[model samples]
Target: MIRVAILISGSGSNMLRLVEDMTGDHPARPVLVASNEPAAGGLAKAAALGIATLAVDHRDFPRDRPGFEAALLRPLLDTRPDIICLAGFMRILTPGFVDRFAGRMLNIHPSLLPKYPGLDTHARAIAAGDTEAGATVHLVTSELDSGPILGQARVPVLKDDTPQSLAARVLTQEHRLYPAVLRRFSAGDKTPVMLGSEGLVRGS
Candidate 1:
């Protein structure tokens, strides 16, 4: 069985979906859910679903980046997760911390990655006059959102689409793509699966 540990910083809708997907006829299971914020609503949701939860408040650490990342490592090490899923986790992890997990970590980004790799992706896409925008599930590397892409779901950007409207559409795609990618990862495959202009493509 693939044991998973999830990290979240806000409402855990994506975490909930991952838990549900893993529990259904699959060997993957979420053993722990950790949050950097004590007030994160995902902690409660994880509790309700009978998943073990931990709150490692990032603010309690010293202001130095290394000290803060060291604090974050404790729960993750304790859980001994086979895979770590970053579900709306807000903090930018240190490179050392990211390397510790390496391919074992995954993150779902808001925009079809390699495009808008940072914050305000939806608004930025609209401003740039992009005709298509979506979400990506990728392996976590030391670089920010530059990891090997695992899966993606694209939505055409309509001329009438506002940032908020486009975001709503992309978020729905995220909820679907993230869980699918998790299942694929748990199955011991590292290949990339993507939806491109030519339909679904799997890359070595």
Candidate 2:
């Protein structure tokens, strides 16, 4: 079984979706969930689901990113996860830390990518008068959100849509797309899965 370690922040909605989808007959198993905040709601949610959870509070270390990651790596390394999934993980990981996992790390971003690579994605899309907005699952390259795309699912920017309304819709697609992509990913298939108007299309 492929061992997956999920990193989360805040409510961990995506993390929960990943855990739920990876059960019984799935190609992977969620072995651990780690957070940068001790009070991250996901920690308790993950623990309640019987998965191991750990937190290395970044705030405690002030500006010491390396130190925080080092402490976070303790429980992480012990799990021997085959892959690390960043599900709403808020911390900006250092290159050294991200490099250690390299291609083994995956992240779900809130945009179609090669477009909006940072925060305020939905609002920006609306301001630009985009007809469609979406989410992407990609490799965790050193550059933030600049990773090779693995899969993407688009959602229409409905008429008179606010950022909040648009975000809610895109998030739903993220929950579905992330899991489907993961199932293929764990099976050693990195072919891009595009969920668009044409339905699910596979690419080389």
Most TM-score-accurate candidate: 2
Cand. 2 Cα-lDDT: 0.91
Candidate 2, residue 191: Cα displacement in angstroms equals 0.8
Tens-place lDDT per residue, model 1, 1-204, is 889999999999889888889976776999999998999999999998889998888888767778877776876688789899999999899888898888889999999889999899989999999989988998889889999888888888889998899998888777777887888789987666665433344352
lDDT of each: 0.86, 0.91
TM-score computed on alpha carbons, candidate 1: 0.92
TM-score of each: 0.92, 0.95
* TM-score, prediction 2: 0.95
lDDT of 1 at 180: 78
